[model samples]
Target: LRRKRSSVLRNPPPLTTATILSKTYYNVNSHQPESLDWFNVLVAQTIAQFRSDAQHDDAILRSLNNVLNGPQIPDFLDEIEITEISLGEDFPIFSNCRVIPVEEDGIGGGAGAAMGEGGRLQARMDVDLSDFITLAVETKLILNYPKPRVAILPVALSVSVVRFSGTLSISFIPSSPPTPSPTTLAFSFLDDYRLDLSIRSLVGSRSRLQDVPKIAQLVEQRLHSWFDERCVEPRFQQIVMPSLWPRKKNTRGGDDEDVGHDRR
Candidate 1:
């Protein structure tokens, strides 16, 4: 009796990535969300949390201050001290969505629910982060007209960014067997995100210091690259994919071959 039970257990039902893919998209089509509002809210809250958390982190604050104010002296520039940097209050606003359908071959070609067998979503949004910056700088005196020994001055720099937007492509596939409980879902990013950055500022630390505008431009470029690497890329690769599609245990017993067909 033990031998028979063991044999029965050994030949447990087979499950494959293909099976999971089918069930995942099929269920997604069935349980289609009424609105993408939740996603919008999620993004907004995430940005807010990131800002709040970053502000609280002493290391981050100090590091940023150092970067802006540190003793990196260039030609005609003596020192630049960034006193404050206020991140904008803007949140991610959901603009549009495009639905994609993936086939059993793991190819996404068709559009809308007609190809709901393997449904994917492409969501787009805009992010505006106009950083308000305060700078104190000491410049090299080109002319001999010095009223005081120290030439330190206050500078208000406004890096007014119009927008930074990107499109997020998501693919939902299945996990686990088709049981009484709801089917678990896994997902991946189908495409890369490209963020556009725009900056407008009237920055002049001193009438003689012409490099302040250039410095602002440098800061803008640095910010764009930094966000692309640290924030956007990691958000998709590390956070979104892992959070949505957690690794599941292999439930199969023996042979890769199924005991029976994978019923959709």
Candidate 2:
């Protein structure tokens, strides 16, 4: 969150025209959503291949571990170690895939957010993943202020994503010169969603408390809150999509790699 805040501060909002809203055209809600059954099948195949690759390699796990350990630890936390990770055995099922009109800001109607004279199209899908995906980590919780390292507790937690059912809405934001950013894909989950988690926790140094009900409850609540703040309902996630146009820097298939001048 600190990193995100700093980045937001560094790169302020781009300048925009005062009459941009007046020039915009909004999507009408009169038309029904268009089905995308064929699209669903193609996406399913891609997910299957991804799961197959995950099973054969620890690359995903290594990357996940690096992400967890890469961030700077706060003064009140230390010695964070990833113990285990399990990528679920089954694939996510995406059904009821359909495209619908949305606001220019990429907010879909299903999210119950306010709309206006804005224009864009968004794809909505029902995603269901029923499998056990778990991550276990051990860290130390340090207590300071009154005195340095007054208390240090070894906290171990294992959280399993038991099941997830949600309505995922995806949309695209057109690239513009003023922003100095690429075309972006934005996605978010509606407020109405079900997420089941199995969490286990142990906290202490020598005499450990295993699966304490209060700790489990707190962790579960925190996880849900964290998720809601980022990518739920009105809040959405955006990914900058790089230009796909072939470029000499990445061109291949010649007598030698990066030899774009040579004909294949």
Candidate 3:
């Protein structure tokens, strides 16, 4: 086994001091920072479309169920099931958009403010959503820390988004060569962003418990921890933006049932 492992463990190649590029962009037209007013109009239209779909289709709901029912349920928890989901009837209002230049290593995948040339442009906007988007779940809490199945407690929880107000920043990064990657879009929320949740919990069986304050507290904490770990300030997500190149999916009127719409 050691010999087999060693066979595949050859020495790694040495690193280059600096990456060499195959292409660089130089243009006569200056890269002007956008006001994002028109962009906001476009975004609002897109979100309206999404809400329309949610009202008629369960595709988004299914996706939520799949994501919430994570494969790695904790040992103390039996199964985490999403019993209900509400995408909400209201829309998010985006405003106060402006462009700023920052270094590439700052929060949201960029450095601090840039002085002159060595900086990237990013768009920051304020988003406010005061909708009742929610998810309700059912699960069993297993008391198996010191012993095996000493007792099984049922837990039903529902969390509602009372409000969310945030500063959202979006930045674009071009593909660099040597190993070419697609131009990517990245975005993240600032630390000052706020999220308000209303959580309700029911525990026990035969004689089921309802609205236990501690359970609600714990669930809210866990949800915040989960959100912070992945998307809050200093963290960001980069994804290849969908090709703006016109396609049948963008066709007016429907000959379409496109799972690719799920990409959003």
For candidate 2, give the lDDT.
Answer: 0.73
Which pairs of residues collide in model 2? Answer: 26-118
My TM-score estimates for the predictions, one after another, are 0.43, 0.65, 0.68
Tens-digit lDDT track of model 3 for 13-68: 53221211112232213534335567557877887788787889878877876776
Total clashes for model 1: 0
Q: List the candidates ranked by lDDT, beginning with the highest.
A: 2, 3, 1
Off by over 4 Å in 1: 1-18, 25-34, 46-60, 66-80, 95-160, 170-220, 227-236, 239-264
Please, what are the lDDT tens digits per residue for candidate 1 over residues 1-264?
656766667663544434654765634344433346676789879978987897777765677667755677443344554544566676655544544443444322222234334434333232233333232333332222354333433344445444544554444423223433322223233335444444333333546433355656776787766665544522333221123222233234666646344433
Q: List the residue pairs that clash in candidate 3.
A: 103-111, 104-110, 104-111, 105-110, 105-111, 106-110, 106-111
How many residue-pair clashes does candidate 2 contain? 1
* lDDT winner, 1 or 2: 2
Distance from true location, Cα of 11 in model 1, Å: 8.0
Model 2: per-residue Cα lDDT over 132-177, one tens digit each: 9899999988989699999988889899999999999987665555
As a TM-score, model 3 comes out at 0.68
- What is the lDDT, from 0 to 100, of the residue 62 in candidate 3? 76
